[model samples]
Every structure is written in C-alpha cells, then in structure tokens.
Target: MFRLALKSLLNRRGTVLLTVFTIALSTALLVGVERVRSEARSSFASTLSGTDLIVGARAGTVQLLLYSVFRLGEPTANVSWATYQQIAAAPAVAWTVPISLGDSHRGYRVLGTTGAYFEHYRFGNRQPLAFAHGEPFAGVYEAVLGSEVAAKLGYSLGDDIVIAHGIGRVSFSNHDDKPFRIAGILAPTGTPVDRTVHVPLAAIEAIHLDWQSGTRLPGRGISAEQALTHDLTPRSITAFLVGLKSRVATFQLQRQINEYRGEALSAILPGVALQQLWSLTGVAENALRLVAACVVIVGILGMSTALLTTLNERRREMAILRSVGARPRTILGLLCLEAMSLTLAGIVLGVLLLYAILAAVRGYAASQFGLFLGLGLPTAAELYALAAIFSAGLVAGMVPAWLGYRRSLSDGLAVRT
Candidate 1:
C-alpha cells in the first residue's frame, strides 16, 4: 500500500510537491513563531537574574522595570542620594548599585553607575559582566562602553567621547568640553546593557554642573579640571538594584521601602515584576500563536482540497485496483498513507529550514535586535507543535480517504466521455 501510494504521488508530483511546500511553509511559520516567542520570554526573564529587588521612586512595578532595567522609558521621579544611601545601609541589604540616567551619547543611553555594577549586575544564568577590552571606568572623566556601543560607534579605549545633556541623539547642549576617555568595553550581554554607555554616577553630575534647564549655561565655563575640583556627588539617582544578605528578608525589605517616611518609594522583586510583564504581553503572544495556527489550518485544508480534486482524475485507477480484488479499505489506506507521507516530509523540511535560518541569523539577531536564538535541538514544546500539525494532516487526509472509500467500483468503471 505504501509503495502504491508513493508511485501515485510520484505520478502527480507537480501537485503533490506544491501541496507539500504549502504545508511546509505553514509549519515553519507555526514553529518559528513559537521558538521566537519562547526565546524572547527567556531573554526578558534572564535580563536581571541575579538581582533580588529593584528600588525606585513610587511607580508601577512594570514601569519601574521598563525604565530602570530595560531603558525603555523615563522615570517618574528620582530617588534622593540620601535615601539610596539609607537603603544601602539596611542590615538586610548585602549591596546596592545606584543608577542615574537622563543622559545620552549619540542615541545610546548613558548609565551612571559605580564600579560595583560590573561586579554585581548579571544576565543569563547569573553570568557576571566581563570586559571585551579595557576595564571599568575608574576616573570621573573616564567611561566604559558596552560591547554594542563600542562596535556600533567604532570606539576604543583612550578615545574621547562627549556626553550629551539629555537623552536625545541630537542635543543643542553638549558637554564637549569635558569629554570622557573610553576606559573599558564590556562583552556583549544580549540585553539592554549592550546598548548602554557606562560611567561613574559622578560623571552624570559633572556634565550637568554647567548646565541648567537641560541646556549649558551660556558664558559660564567650567573646564574639566575645574569641574573635578568641585563637588560631583549625585543629588539623586533614577533607581537602584539591591541584593539581600538573606532571601528570607526580601519581603521585609520590600515592605520597609514601600512604607518609608522620607519619600515615596517602591521596591519590587525582579521575578514577580517579570511575571507581571509577561501577563501584559501574553495577549499579543497569544494573538501571534493564533495567527500561526490559522495558517497551519489553511495549509492542511489546501492539502485536503488538492486530494479531493485529484479523486476524479484517478477514478479509472481506483477502478483498476478494485478489479484486481483490492478492498475499498485498501484504497482508503493508500490515500491516507499519501497524506501522512506528505505531512511528514513537509515537517522534516520545515524544521531543517528553521534551523538553517536561525544559524545564519543568530548573531545578527543578538547584536541588532537583542534576540538570542539558540541553534540547538527543537524544544519539547516545538516537538509537540510539530506532532500536532502532523496529526491534523492525518485527520485532514481522512476526509478525502472516506469519500474515496464510499465510491463504488461500478461508479468508477462507468463509461464516460
């Protein structure tokens, strides 16, 4: 039966091939979307794996995560440097790394942080930050470039780069006088960190010393040397990441920060905040899955349509098999085998194509889009999705197979023009 089905499909290779290609494309779409969706969530979850709580001015948890960790938006307010220090001094707090934003260098965000950032910040299974070249910023006038920033801007250690006053790419008020020398370049982290420029928190204060209202004060010149002599301590910071001495005290510390009397503050568990983000994004993810599923259905239906259309043309063939004492059930099984074979072939091709495309674009996706796609075996979820597609194909083919079984040998062998 399998051999006969194979020969029959070979005889109509044109239509069969087209049907297989259609199914292959849809299967690829379904599995590809699933892979990207899963990877994106994994990436987002791992973006701050080592951090316990992210503390910032009172705002929505997701909003705080967006601006603090992802650099997606502006902070609602800043935490006083005094408040940050107080929190750092908490007994339960093991360490805290303050982050000050509101500056940019040529479209990339400038992150004002301390050397502890490199030591504490982590991604992808508690991986520590490593330097691709040079070391962390040491001096007030020095800067560290993320891997992406260095590569994209063609900057290296000892190169002087000016910091802009605001987040805009084109700033009318530039701190050209106090340009920073590149002190370090961090390895690619495949997170928002890659797109950031790291500098001491004091660098943020030093650049804004001669500026007011988001512009450089005219006729008021403070040379880099002169600015260094003056106070460069930051008055406030956008947010801070906190690590606890004991995991059991996380909730206690979070509650304390939320109820602090000096100012309104919010502290969130990074894991919980990430789950909130997933909840918000789940709708769109499901919509994409639904669309992929619809495409798969269309492909399966097209295959069934093709099979039904060919039943008429193969009537004489069916009659010949029936005359040879082949049971109607045998004819049905042949059609069913053909459908399963086509589906299996399509699935194999689609998986191969998916991995091929992923291998070719994996680096590009990581560097350009911050999307990390592993070129590993298909995940269990992906395997399940493929199995579901194959099963649907089997059920779809049964429609045509049933109709073929219902056909009488006399009806097929009847004389027709």
Candidate 2:
C-alpha cells in the first residue's frame, strides 16, 4: 500500500508540489512571527539589567523608562537635582547614576550621565561597558559614543560633533555650537547603550544655558566657548538608575520615593516594571501571532483546494488501483500518505527557506535593530507549533483522499457516468 501510495503521489507530483509549497509558506510565516516575538521580548527584557530601581518624576512608568533607557519618548517632567541627591544619599542606595536625556548628535541619543554610569550600570546580565578607544568622558565637553553612533557616523576618538536640542528628526534649536570632543567609543553592547552618546550632566546643562523648554534663547545667545565660564548647573534630570546597598532596602526606598514630601517622584524595580509594560503591550504581540497564523491558514486552504480540484483528473488512476485488487483500506492509506508526504515536503522546504533568510539577515538585524536572532534549535513551543502544522496538513490531505476512495468504490469497474 505504501509503495503504491508513493508511486501514485509521484505520478501526481505536479499538483502535489503546488500544494506542498503552499503549505510550506504558511508554516514558515507562523513559525517566523512567533519566534520574532519571543526573541524581541527577550531583547527588550535584556535592556534592563543589574539595576535594582529606576527613579523618575510622577509620570507613566513606561514613559519614564522609554525616555530614560530607550530614548523613544519625551520625559513628562525632570526629577529635581536636589531630589536625586537625596535619593543617592539614601541609606539604601549603593550608587545612583543620573540620566539627562532629550539631546542627540545627528541620530544617536545623548545621555548626560556621570562616570558612575560606566562603572555601575549593567546590560544583558551585568555586562560592563568597555571602551573601544580612548577613556570615559573626563570633562564637561568630552563625549563617549556608542558602537552604533560611532559606526554610523564614522566617529572616532578626538572627533568633534555638535548636538541638537530635541530628540526627534527635526529640531530648530542647536547647542551653543561648542562641539563635543569625542573622548571614547564603546564596543557594541547590543542594548540601548550601543546607540547612545554619553556626556557629563554638566555638559547637558551647559548646552541649554540660554535655551528654555526645547527652543533656543532667540535674542540671548552664547558661543560654546563663552558658555564654559558660566555655571551650568542642571536644575533637573530625566531619571536616575539606582542600585541598592542591600536587597532589604528596596521596599524601603520605593516607599520613600513614593512618599517623598518635597517632590512628586516614584521609583520602580526595573524587572517588575518591564513585566508590567510587557503585559500592557501583550495584546499587540498575540495579534501579530494570530495574523501570521491566519496567513498560513490561507496557504493551507490553497493546498486543500488544489487537491480537491485534482480529484477529477485522478478518477481513472483510482479506478485502475481498485481493479488491481487494492483494498479500500489500501486506497485510503494511499491518499493519506500522499497528503502526509506533501506536508512533509512543504515543512522541509520551509525550514530551509527560513534558515536561508535568517542567514541572509543575521548581520543586518543585529546591526540595525540590536536584535540577535539565533538559528539554533527551535524552542519547544516552536517545535509544538510545527508539529501541529504537520498534523494539520496530514488531516487536510486525508479529507481529499477519503473522497477519492469513495468515488473509486461508487464507480468500481467503470468510469463514472
């Protein structure tokens, strides 16, 4: 029966191939979308590492994180400098690195932070930032560029670049035109750090001495050199990354931040806050999966349609098999085998195609999106999804096979009327 099934399917290879390719495309899309989502979640989660808490003004925690770490959104309000000093001086705080955002050189974000950032901040599970060239920013105007910033802009040590006032694509305000001397360039970290340009908080204040909000002073202006003599004290910063001296002090500090008497500020554990943010965005994630699954389903439907249409052409073939003393069960097995075979072929082809795609794109995705997609073994969930697809294909084939078998019996020993 199996031999006959193989011979029969081979004879119908033209139609079978079309069906297989159809199912293959569907399976690949379903698997690919799901894998992308899972990996992206992991990538986003990796953005927050080793930091116990993030303290910022009383706005959305998600917004605070986006501006503080990801540089995607505007800060609702800046936390007071005095408040940050208090938070840093808290008994529970081990080290605090203040971040002043909303400036960018060309396209990369400018992070005005202290040297403690290079020492205490961590990414991707406590990995430290390493210098690719030169040292950390030592003076107010010295800058450290992330790997992306350096590579994209072709920046190197001792290079000078001017920053713009706002974070977006278009901003009218320019910094006091004092170019920042590139003190260092960092090795690629694959986190948001790889896209940032770091400078001292004093430099941030210095750039905006004559600016208000996001605009330049209009009539009041100072050359980058003239601004040097002025006291560039930062009135506020976007947020502060906090590491606790003891694990026990986390709850205490969160309580302190939430109940602070002077200012409306809040503190959040990075991991917990990330979890909450993901939950809020989970709907869109699942919708992506569903949309991919639907696309694959359409392909499977194409496979079914191809098989059903070809049944008419295979009528004589089935009649010949019955005449040759093949049992009804044998005929049924033949149809099922053909369906299963097509599905297997589709699956194998799709896997190869997916591999080729990933190989072609691994470097680009890593460089552009900071997402590292490994072509290693598929996760267990992925395997399950694949298995489900395989089984579904087999079943889809079985339906047409059964119909052919019935037609064979109903018209045994003769062509249909």
Writing each residue's lDDT as its tens digit, candidate 2 over 1-417 gives 667767877777887778777877877888887777778778888876889889899877777777787777787788999888977887778899999988887767889999999999788877888998999998889999999889988888898888888776566666737779999999888788988989999999888887886777788887778788988877889899999888888888898898998999878887777878889889998898888778777776777777788777777777777787877777678877877777788888887777778888877897777787778878888888889888887777787878877774547446455
- Could you give candidate 1's per-residue lDDT for residues 126-162 as a string of tens digits? 9999999999888998999988899989998899999
Clashes of each: 0, 0
lDDT of candidate model 2 versus the reference:
0.82
- Candidate 2 global TM-score: 0.93
lDDT of 1 at 288: 92
Q: Which ten contiguous residues of candidate 1 have the minimum total lDDT?
A: 367-376
Residue 113 C-alpha lDDT in model 1: 97
Q: Model 2, residue 72: displacement in angstroms?
A: 1.4
Q: Which stretches of candidate 1 lie over 4 Å from their true place?
A: none
